[model samples]
Target: MATSSICRRRSLSPRRHLTTSPASFILLPLFSKKRTMWCYQNDRCKDNFKKSFRLLKGCASERLSALVVVLLLAIVSYTLYEVQYKTGIEIVPFLPIDDSGFETYNEKLLNDVVTSKAAQNQLPRGSLMCWVMTTSIYHKTRVNAVNSTWLPRCDSSHILTNSPRFLDDQIPYHTVFNSLPESYYKLFWKTRLALLYVYQNVSSEFDWYFKADDDTYVIVDNLRKYLARFDPEKPYFIGYRLKRRMPNNGYNAGGSGYAMSRAAMRIFAEKLFHDKSLCPYHEWEDYAIARCLASMNIYPLDSRDELGRQRFLPWRPEQHFHADLTPSFLMDPIQFWGPSIFHENLVSMHHLKPDEMRLIDGLLYGVSQGIWKPQKAPNSSTSLVNSTEASPMEDTIQPPTVSF
Candidate 1:
């Protein structure tokens, strides 16, 4: 009975909850709150660090991508430059712009010309006139050579000289102009007079006028081909252009010969000849014409070959034309007075003796008929020629100024 009472007493004594110790009950809640706060702060710091890392990674990625793009662009540009250097073809010459801010030769114009030429079978032969500048004494041989060779290629041809002669069908120019003594100094006057006479007398018959010296050898077929690209109605002057020691807008080297459109000729006749005081009378007819044309704003066209070589050659085969290059044919005693590289398409050669003219006449005729092969000269190397040098392809060429 005493034990039972003690057990009941013990059971009833702590009817108190035994879930926690006394010390835990006092400090556990506070410790739990402190741990939770520390965990929350640690989690916030981790999130902030992760966000910062992600932003830094994104910035690095963008910078790397931009760097990669710049590198690729640089590589591509270098590759193109290398390719252009390796290939000999130049799409654009060194100096593409002229002093006047116009493109000297544009790809667009070339394309247009080529496209237009695809359909035309041949340039109209009736539209051309060839004028041979000759004296009375040498007409028999030189005139005969032209007649036998290239003169027949034109629609009409005339000899311009101031000489009285017994009228022969072969030599009609004797009666063409009143007798002016055949002097070198009087050439400019004769040329002026000839231009005036032709303009007044027979301008209605032709659309294009070609002027050549007696010693000049011309490929009329090639000339016609060249002329086909331009319209006769436009004021175009085509020739071997000379910038050095020329008038304000450049002039044609007369030894190589020159061609002027009907419109250009009309301007010369109407405006240039009438004003005797416009330019001083000089011995060089070609320079005088250039000065006269410059005043009227008619500039010379650059008439180079497909290879960018001058079609009209002024120098003989033995002479040096530029500082770096000499013009010559490979064959000893050159039949053609041009660099052998351009022999196949030789336009005009200067200083052709009357006999040599006859020989070339036969050779050129044979080539035209495909019966003869044009033999290349053995040592005639065209390595030194850079069309960009001394050509209209340069930047700021010597401005054209009149020379006596």
Candidate 2:
């Protein structure tokens, strides 16, 4: 009985110890609060770090992209600038060299020509007169030939003068030595003369001007008549169409005839004067003209008939006309010589031989006589001749056959 009582007391003592422990309750609540606070702080720090990392990454990407774009734009701009400023070099003969020095005759001539001369020179009304300037070597054979044949046939009013020569005897040794490929030196002299002519004379006297080779044959009347049909108020540059596939560097099949408007001439002349270094010394005159025109946004015009045939195609022998050789008949010939029929009627016919001239004259006389003598109704063949007035396609008519 005594052992049992001791065990019961021990059990009751354990129950008493549980009921009296207040320190355990306080310490548990404090520990739980501290744990929850630590967890909350750690989560806040993690979220803030993630947001800062994303913002930094976004800023860095945008900056890198902007830098790349700027670099690319800078490279393209520099390349284009270089191309515009670069000048090409070549070799050609210089002009206007005299015993004293470079001939100042061109300057004198330009100064002498007043604005009144241009207005009264039989040029078309409200149209620009362009004087194409060229200098020949003036050798005895060439001068005599030009004087006797070309000048008379073309009926040029300007006189031939020996004011310039294209030799380099007067140039210093250092200049010759520094100018390698020698051809470039000659070309430089020629270009300089041409530019000087433009600066001193062409800009003031004419609305536009062309510089070309002496061998080129121009039907001035035809050119003038054609251009007369178009409105001249807008910016325009016309030249023969070239059929090559390459870009601007190929040979121009259109020959050397190039046209520019008054605006283009003024702009080009101004730019060339200030930036003389931009001129390239080259053999291809047409290319040089084209490049210059392109800088000012000018282009060449295409030549096509109403039926879509090229105007300059090889001529068939079957097509000929009596009136084709006469001036009062077709208006298309006016494109070249402005308002002057003298050039087309008299001068152009001079190139033909005596026999050819006689044939044309006889045809005109016969046609005139036939029309005057005949009395025909509207249905008759003779009336057809009268009905056919001057037309643009007059050059395409077949002529009557005559046995020699």
Candidate 3:
């Protein structure tokens, strides 16, 4: 059996039980991560397919039976050939790619949703356009709760789904007419495509961009005030920082949500999107976006309060506040449960039920108590608060001195 140890570092309150980076860390789940498991991806199953084919052939040697058997075998062989020989085509069963040789929705109609409206003209100075990644299944459930609760507070918000029927519902959704199937693993693609669309169409409208999930409950006013000190002109990526395979820095955790400056959004759309090596596909949505941002020298910044209490939490209030917690093997291993106390200026939290979101609305007592607004440090003029290693976005991405 393998051995593991929980090393608690010195801190005031609840501290980490283990010290491991996300790159080499994820462990202890009784079940392993799900595989795409395409039919052609498994070679061992080919023998079973061959056995079945032989039995079916023996069922009848009649001319019609033989013709049907030959047709089926040819189709199978051709599918295998396509998978093995073609590098461009991917047959991910869960996320079906649209190969109709055309875009799904009318581009003009889709762009018209936000193309004409200027966020800067209508909203506050530091306008934030929040994009919530959701699906058709949760269109009515979680999305409705989010819209009814905190989403309205945002300067502008839109639902990102492949479903085009949002037009019929008269909801302000930025639907990309594509055949991308809705699946948990496909979030990376959804996030990337949404940013690209926003950049191409309405980049000039918003000062900052915030992305979240259907279950995420964001204190919009808190987030807007928290990021007010940082110049949106300078690239800022702040959220629940998760240290992944990268050497020095980490990416913001996706569930709790992440905020990016106007500059960061432009850099990602223009520079990172064109380069495959710099912004390649990855399994996790947050990690993939972080990889792209990191290449452009925009890393996740510390979004904690002055006392080092996190502003972004990956779990609900009860999970963090609960005493006598039982350890679990299935829980996400990358959580940074510092001090076990909720910060007064917390901006976001994940894994919330619809009612829980409403419950949080009623309990906004601590939101404005001690907001961490970045200001002139003791002796610094422009240096940001809690950002010892962060710098403004450069003309070109600086290669990290060291990386995985």
In the order shown, the candidates' Cα RMSDs to the true structure are 30.1, 28.1, 25.5
lDDT value for model 2: 0.38
TM-score of 3: 0.57
Model 3, CA-based lDDT: 0.63
Q: Could you tell which candidate, 1 or 2, scores higher by lDDT?
A: 1
- TM-score for each candidate, following the candidate numbering: 0.55, 0.37, 0.57
**Model 2: per-residue Cα lDDT over 40-125, one tens digit each:** 46755445445434544554575688799999988976555444323232121232111121232123434433232312332232
Query: For model 3, where is the 10-residue window of minimal lDDT?
Result: 1-10
lDDT order of candidates, top first: 3, 1, 2
**Number of colliding residue pairs in each model:** 5, 23, 1
Question: Model 3, residue 207: displacement in angstroms?
Answer: 1.6
Name the best candidate (by lDDT).
3
Considering every candidate listed, which one attains the maximal TM-score? 3
Whole-structure CA lDDT of model 1 = 0.59
lDDT (0-100) at residue 94 of candidate 3? Answer: 39
lDDT of 1 by residue, 140-254 (tens): 6776676566766777676665453422554435233344455665576667666665555545446788888888888888888788889888888877666544534567878
Measured by TM-score, how close is model 1 to the native structure?
Answer: 0.55
* Candidate 2 vs candidate 3, lDDT winner: 3
Give the alpha carbon lDDT tens digit for every residue of 320-341 in model 3.
6653233431122334454555
